[model samples]
Target: MKGLLLRWLILTLAILAAAYLIDGIAVAGFPSALAAAALLGILNALLRPLLLLLTLPLNILTLGLFTFVINALLLMMVSGVIGGLKIQGFGSALLASLVISLVSWLLTTLVGNEGKMDVIVLQRRDEDHWE
Candidate 1:
C-alpha cells in the first residue's frame, strides 16, 4: 500500500544519507541510490531473518552484537545485487553498515526515544481510557 511505499522511500533516503556520511557506500546518483536502496530492502527481507535465526547462538553469545555483522553482510550482498552500489571491501562494508545503521537510527529515533524507531505515541485524555 501507500504506507509501505512511503516506508521504502524513507529507508532509501536514510541509506542515501548514510552513504554520504560513510566511505565505500556508493551510488551513482539519485536513481541509482533509490534502486540500491530497494535492493538492500529486498535482500534484508529475504536473507536477514534467516541469518539471524541461524546465528542465534552466536548472537546470544555476543550479546546481540553478531547481528551487526549479519547486517553488514546483507548490505554487501545488496551492493552486489545493485551494480553501481559498490563496497570497496569487507571492512569497508562493515564500517558503512555501522554508519548507515547509526544514521538511520538517529533520524528515526529523534522524535522521542534514543536510537529506537518504530515508536508510537499515545496521548491519554483520561486515566480511565486505558482500562
Candidate 2:
C-alpha cells in the first residue's frame, strides 16, 4: 500500500517534470499533475497490456518501437480525460511519455519496492578471501 502511494507520487513528479521540459505538454498545476498521474497509472494498468497484446505483431515487427506509439496513444487518452492536462499532438505525446518514463524509472530505482530507500547489504565470511 505504501509502495503504491510512493509510486503514485513518483508518477506525479515525473508528470510535472515532463510538463516542465516539454513545450507541447501542459499541466495547469500540481493538482492537475496529480490527477494526470493517477489517470496515467490507471490507464497503463488497465489498457496498456491489452494494447500490447493486440499490437504484438506490430511491436515485434518494429522490435518494440511500436510500444512508444502505444505509450503516446495512452498519453493522448489521458489528456482527453483530464481537463487541466493538455497534450498538443502525437509527437508531443511521444516526447512527453519518454521523459516521464525516464524520470519515473530513475525515481523508482532510488525507492525500493516497499516505498523505502533502496540499500545494498554485503557480508564477508572467514571462508571468503579477497581477490
Candidate 3:
C-alpha cells in the first residue's frame, strides 16, 4: 500500500541520516540504505516481539532501555547479512539504532500513519466561549 511504501522511505531516510551522523556506521549508498531499511523493517516485524518477550526481565530491569539493545542487535544482524552496510562495533550499532529510531519517529509523526494529511475544522457552538 501507499502507506507502507511511505513508511519504508521514511525509514530509509532515517538510516541514511544515522549513517551520515555516526562515525562507525557506514552505508555504501542509497541502494544499500534501502535494502537495510527493508531488512530492518522485516526483522522488527518478525523477530522483535520474540526478542522482547525473551528479554522481558532485562527490559523491565532497565526500564525498557534494553529495547535499544535489542534494536542494536537487529542492526548488527542486518549489517552481517548486507555487504554494503557495515557497523564497526556494538556501540556504533546502538547509537545508530537510537538515531534511526528518533528520525523515523519524527518523520512518521509528520507523515501520519495513513501517509496523508488530514484537515480538521472547528466551529463555535452556543455552549462554547473563548477564554
**TM-scores for all predictions:** 0.76, 0.87, 0.87
**lDDT on C-alpha atoms for all candidate structures:** 0.75, 0.92, 0.93
* Clash count (model 1, backbone only): 0
Return the candidate ranking by lDDT, descending: 3, 2, 1
- Give the per-residue lDDT digits (tens) of candidate 3, residues 37-101: 99999999999999999999999999999999999999999999988899999999999989999
- lDDT of model 2 at residue 121? 73
The TM-score of candidate 2 is 0.87
How many backbone clashes does every candidate have? 0, 0, 0
Per-residue lDDT tens digits of candidate 2, residues 12-51?
9999999999999999999999998899999999999999
Off by over 4 Å in 1: 110-131
User: Model 1, residue 121: what's the lDDT?
Assistant: 71
